[model samples]
Target: MHDLEASLLGGDRDLTLRDLADRAGPGVRPEDVQLFWRTLGLPYADTDERLFTDDDAQAVARIADLERSGRIDRRTAVTLTRALGHQSERLVLWQVEALVEDVAQRRHLDDISARLVVLDRLTELAPVLEAQLVHSFRRHLAAIAGRFAAEFAEARTTEQADPSALPLARAVGFADMVSFTRRTAGLGSTDLSAFVQRFETAARDIVANAGGRVVKTIGDAVLFIADDVVTGARVAVGLAGELGGELEVQARSEEGGLTEGHRGVTPVRVGFVQGRVLSRFGDVFGASVNVAARLTDIAEPSTVLTDPSTAELLAGDSRFVLEPQPPRELQGLGSIAPVLVRQA
Candidate 1:
């Protein structure tokens, strides 16, 4: 009773931590209350400092109750805070217009007009969007971490993979839109928006359907990697074909005015190479990856090209027809002859 009294009337009614404990009821302990604030990364004060307002106290008390009920822990609470902070930093840095546009669509507003409104009301009207973005960022980070842990753990536990794990051979590939800069420049804002969206959609669908994992999407291209050479070959072929078809469709559409007579919507040139790659930070590296990207750069529009190794691996695959092109003096890479693929 004395402690409760000390808390309630304590510190000249400044609504400090002690006062918060007093309002939390007789059953709630002050230690747990303090821990709750600490978990929230709020400063702990011993003096008669008004660190927590009534609302803050109530929130802490509720969180404490949730903790006691096995809903969360001090560590988890801290992680949530850190994760939220990191996500906020990224959102502020990127100014991702897609996020704002998504909210606009949900609210039945025109995306373009809503973009301006979203910019103006970001701090107020889009709390839900912000929260969702935070949640997504956390989930992605966790997933990536989990995958890394699993891979490393497997490497350590299995004699076949060693503590450090020998790098495994994989087929790496890249598909990039040719003349993307020129095409985008020729487009209006609305057309440019649709063009980028259609390209991404097509790329993702093609990559996944061909049993390849999309590593990342640069502005006008996507990178993919597959475990086997055959899968990589199929991925390249499928991606090129899909891009060609989509480009044709897009060219006929009004938004595709930039591609009306240019054969296709900046046809994606794909290239693949089979070799060892280092997977880290949700990305791949090594010479093979580099070569694949360079190959994509040199490939003709709407075509799939592959290094000699990848072509050799898929030589027996009757579903594909491969034809070699003349040796080109690729920069950074010595003389090389790449094979182009066609449907059989």
Candidate 2:
């Protein structure tokens, strides 16, 4: 086996496309295997080359078994395959790049050599990564299951007892770095990466500690959501006040340490809204998301803004103070008043 194939397939390059299909047992057609392969985001060719592995064959066989047992229909099977493919493609690339960057920095190697080292390291780390992935998937699945169970119980006890009408209420928010483009315009790759990493790490820590989950991070902004308004409020306030203040202080302390033309501090503006959101594909959407993002666009550095609805929800809470802002016309969203929030 060639080095690349051996490294990737773990020396399992004995089976061809035809052989793999046969090994998947009866009722599993070559076309079915092709479909599975394509659904996994892999390009397929009609050659009899020994390019497939035992693991690949077994995986296809398991899918066939699932279909035969009626555990999943063909459409569902394809969806599951696509989801795994889509997510894993990005996951593997991110992990590999991270490893390559570490190797390059630590050993002072060129990009080519760094990639070669990363490929070698991956062969050794693959099993560990796989195990960790499985472990984390189970833990996350358990959390989702527990949440659904509790929500279903509550729904059953409610007067309506109708799941369709009462969608899940959540607090969605955005925290955006101020003047990100101008701040990083002169930074080299290394410095830019460091700056982004610092912001992302700090933002994630603050959001997680405040009982909110980060949905995603754009280049200069983070989107987060919480099951309750109070938790979201805490996250917003923490990011704008505590975390933002700390970064500012650090920037001042390290001002002399920075390279010329590089900014030391990352200031962020945050906005939050509490309302029902349409959750799909591990992302949240709808007007609440739009409003929160719009509010973030208008918020000043180290400050949090919320819509009237969120302010009302948080009004009775002594931990926060809300001051109403003048009605401002937002693009796409009509004229609306927002409230500034601060820790009491």
Stretches of model 2 off by over 4 angstroms after superposition: 1-4, 16-27, 47-49, 159-166, 246-263
Relative to the unseen true structure, what is the C-alpha lDDT of residue 276 in candidate 2, on a scale of 0 to 100?
81
Best by TM-score: 2
State the lDDT of candidate 2 residue by residue for 1-344, as single tens digits.
27756766656577777876787787777788889989999987774876688878888888878888999999988988987998899889978888887998899888799999887777678889989999999998998798789878886887763466337788999999988887776555656676787788899999989988899999989999998899999999999975465332122123324443422556799999998888766678878999999999899999999999889999999999999999988789999899999999
Worst 10 residues of 2 by lDDT: 247-256
Error of 1 at 205 (Å): 1.3
**What's each prediction's TM-score?**
0.59, 0.87
> TM-score for model 1?
0.59
Clashing residue pairs found in predicted model 2: none
Candidate 1 lDDT tens digits, 159-263: 663436338667889999877887666555545666888788888888878877898889888999886788888889888877866353223344433444443
**lDDT score of residue 42 within candidate 1:** 49
